[model samples]
Target chain A: MAINKIVASVEEAVADVHDGAVILVGGFGNIWNAPSYLLTAISKLPVKNLTVVSNSGGFGIEIWGGVFGVHEHDVEVLHRTKQCTKHIVSAPTNPLVVNTLETRYRAGEVEVEMCAQGTLAERVRAGRAGLGGILTPTGVGIPEIQRDKPVIEIDDRKYLVEKAIKGDFALIRAHKADRWGNLVYKGTSRTFNATMAGAARVTIAEVDEIVELGELDPEAIVTPGIYVNRVVLRQ
Target chain B: MTEKFRIDDQTMALRVAKEFKDGDVVNLGIGVPTLASNFIPGDREVIFHAENGVLGYGNICTAGEGSYDLLNAGGQPVEPRPGMSILDHAESFCVIRGGWLDWTVLGGLQVSEKGDLANWMVPEKKIGTIGGAMDLAFGAKKVIVVMPHNTKNGGYKIVKECTYPITGFRCVDLVVTDIAVIEVTPEGMVLKEVAPTWTPEEVQQLTEPRLIIAPDLHEIELA
Candidate 1:
């Protein structure tokens, strides 16, 4: 039988995600580009002890107004449902307010690995590229960011070694996709989604619209179909 | 209410914007630094770099005119200029980590006399987030802190030493606050400009580090 990438629903898309899974949610800038349908579907399923990686730690009640409604992203909903075991993120705040992650962290209910926003992005990209790691000077002298990481000096300049971060599954969002799984992102919603397309064992995309093959302009394609294992059209 | 010889946010931003040279590339932090873009003079074409990925965005977008898709690093929707380009997270950080920023204006909780920045977290708060603070502080050619002279609880922010977690060590070059503009030099904090109504001695009382008054100390003017 020929492989068909399209899935019936968000629940079916995330159905294979087991407990203790490491999920990387793509997109930044609130939930405008986040895979909200996939996130909401995951929130309803019986999963726990998950490790979530993203740009910000997650969203809170504050940023519920965007392209999507107030259902919340997988990161925030995972924390709310006590399903997340840890988070490796750059900005962990809920933007303007204290969030469940903060409370859970303080209460020792979850673990967090704080990283620089850029380093976080690069590390994820490195994972997708199959590189060993990234050497950056951004967090050289800072103690908290260094976190006992190795610092090597090249040409008398110092750089910290940050390992690549791959995930079991990468949840991404795209503005448009062709039946072949070619993706095109719109505006700033293309933040981390493009880099995360091929960085995981399984890459799933929740797109606003899916067009017929040959409909998307070849030059506008951001993520090719080979990287994506499944495609779910947003309900 | 009695006059406190204090400046508003816009005035503070104006003072900081004057520091940028023509054709400089700058990264503005979330709060007070966000206002500096509005005060950049028309004659000087300073490029504003938002970490989330727009290179040449001009100003904050009014609510009715913007979609959630065109936002700055602060997550506020903004308008892109004539030469704006969008990049992904990896490429955006390449701009930051490559030392392309000529000036980075950041807000601080405390700045030590030794130029250590403690801005990402409050000690009492159990959970805190350090977004791009470390990266900007480490890679920018010059880091200028823009914040209030004192905490909301009336404690001095420029201290001999910081009690909270440090963001970057000896990275701050200048600090623009509500009451005064100070520079972090090898010797100590140099008092450069003050509010018109405040005296040097009065500003000293609010500051914790010993002030080295500059020979050309003058009042801050916003034009």
Candidate 2:
């Protein structure tokens, strides 16, 4: 039988994701690009001890909740519901924000691992490309960041060797996708979603529109279907 | 409370914006650096690159006028200019890591005589995040910093060596502060220009490292 990559529901798309799973959520602190439906669904599940890797913890949190009515659920919902036990993110929150993941971090409720934005994306890319790691000049001298990592010196400059980060599942938002899962993204929303596409064992995309396989222009597709396991329409 | 000695944020931004060459692709870090984008002379066609993904984005829009999909790295809504193009995060950093960016203006908490930068973390405060500052600091052809001359409590930020964690070593080329425009040279900090009310000697008193006045030192132009 021919395989169908389309899932009937977002819940079913993320059904296999359970406790202690390393899941990648894609977005760059913008509500439009974030996988809100997937994130919202994840919040409802009984999953715990999830290590989430993303660019920012969520968008609009600094706005003291969303100024715009676009986002259904920010990543903070997952933290609030106790679905995520740890977060490996770059821009977590502004220090001034009243209620943030930093509060939980201070309480030792959730574990937080900070990664540089470029390093985070590159590490995830490395995971998909089957590379050992990346040697970057970022975070080389920082005691907290470089203390435990291996350092490689090239051309008289020292670089930290960051290992690739692979997720058990990836939840990404895309602008358009075909039945075969070839995806296209819109504007700033494309930040981390396209990079996180294949960096996981099962890459599930939540898209605004799903077209026929041949409908999407080849040049416009950011992620090929080969990297994607399932596609669900955004609510 | 009139403080004639200090330049306002816009003046500081304009001073740094004047350094941009025509056709230069500049990445402006948040705060003072972000303000530089507003002061870029209309005659110069500088492309603004936001690490969030877009290149050639225009000014930050007013609250109701913005399209949520279009935003800068700081998460503020912006309008993309004619030549603007948006790419993914990896490709955006590729522009930085590949040494394609012409210049990047960042804010610094502390800058050493050797140009070592420490802008991301202040351990005393538990909350901090290192975004693309490191990549931009090392990747750009020229790394310039726009910051205050001293801390809020009147402590020097330009130091002999940074007490905070280092972001990039010997990376900063220029320093634009409220009181002075200083250049980081191999020998030491060169005082290029000072605020009109403040003399180079006065600015030197606030700086931790010894300031060497340039031969053609002049006051910052406010016009």
Docking class of 1: medium
TM-score, one value per model = 0.94, 0.94
Q: Indicate the worst ten consecutive residues by lDDT in candidate 2 chain A.
A: A59-68
Write down the worst ten-residue block by lDDT for model 1 chain B: B1-10
Off by over 4 Å in 1: A1-4, A61-74, B1-3
Off by over 4 Å in 2: A1-3, A59-66, A95-99, A155-157, B1-5
Predicted structure 1: lDDT = 0.85
Cα miss at B116, model 1 (Å)?
A: 1.6
TM-scores for chain A over all candidates: 0.94, 0.94
Q: Give lDDT tens digits, candidate 1, residues B94-118.
A: 8887889998989999999989899
On DockQ, the leading prediction is 2
Q: Per-residue alpha-carbon lDDT of model 1 for A122-181, expressed as tens digits?
A: 999999999989998877877778889999999999999999999999999998887677
Q: Residue B170 in model 2: shift from native, Å? A: 1.3
